[model samples]
Target: MTERIVVVGAALLDGGRLLAARRSAPPELAGRWELPGGKVEKGEAPEAALVRELREELGVEAETVERVPGEWPLRSPYILQVWTARLRPGSPAARPLQDHDALRWLTPDDIWDVDWLDQDVPAVRETLTRFPTETR
Candidate 1:
């Protein structure tokens, strides 16, 4: 089976907290936490997809700082392209859209508490370690 390419963004907020969204659709994986992003459309750049997905899923605009360099293939058949981003100026309220049910800000240790899609768990774990929380 061909792998699906999905784009996800790692958004950090005040106090070094990361943003995670809950999946609300596709019965099988409903309620699972994941990074905010969606499938990359045909011929679309992953970075562009990340920006679009954030705007569509969360009511905020973001710019990609860099691609989280690595691939985590999930058992669910998705090969995710993860990117790191910082929220844009202005406080925008985020409402669930598409397959998401809710959103939360989490620290590294708190990340594992949420139910995540099988393939996403590894990425989350790796990211938490790679991007340790910075004291501000």
Candidate 2:
């Protein structure tokens, strides 16, 4: 059996808004919305991996505020976990310069409107709950 790969997703919150990225590739996942993150490299700590992935994928320095609390199954041999994050002090706002084609900063009331990846919905919902009601 193939070893399962742990992929971390970031629910990057700035103020009361949550950042959602629109995927652009890997035919199956194309055009869907997701929390931005990448696979954890061998021997890399998950938090460190998450920060690195945010920099690579979003072009900003992020710090993990907390883990969002659960894991979800992706394709076979992959699992998705999410974290709460914020841009590091002095870091610019994130841009969609990588695997994503677009970006949206969703307020709490409208966060549900995006077409999120099915496997990520639960974690996304949990991430949404992390925000204050005024934002959500």
Q: Which one wins on lDDT? A: 2
Tell me the tens digit of each residue's lDDT in model 1 across 17-115: 778889888898888888888778888888888888888888778878766668877556567767778777784866787788888888766777888
Model 1: per-residue Cα lDDT at residue 81: 69
Model 2 poorest ten-residue lDDT run: 127-136
* Candidate lDDT (C-alpha), each: 0.74, 0.91
Q: Write the per-residue lDDT of candidate 2 for residues 2-55, one digit (tens) a residue.
A: 998999999999889989999999888889999999999999988999999999
Segments in model 1 whose C-alpha atoms lie over 4 Å from true places: 1-6, 9-14, 75-77, 130-136
Each prediction's TM-score versus the true structure: 0.83, 0.95
Q: Global CA lDDT of candidate 1, please? A: 0.74
TM-score of 1: 0.83
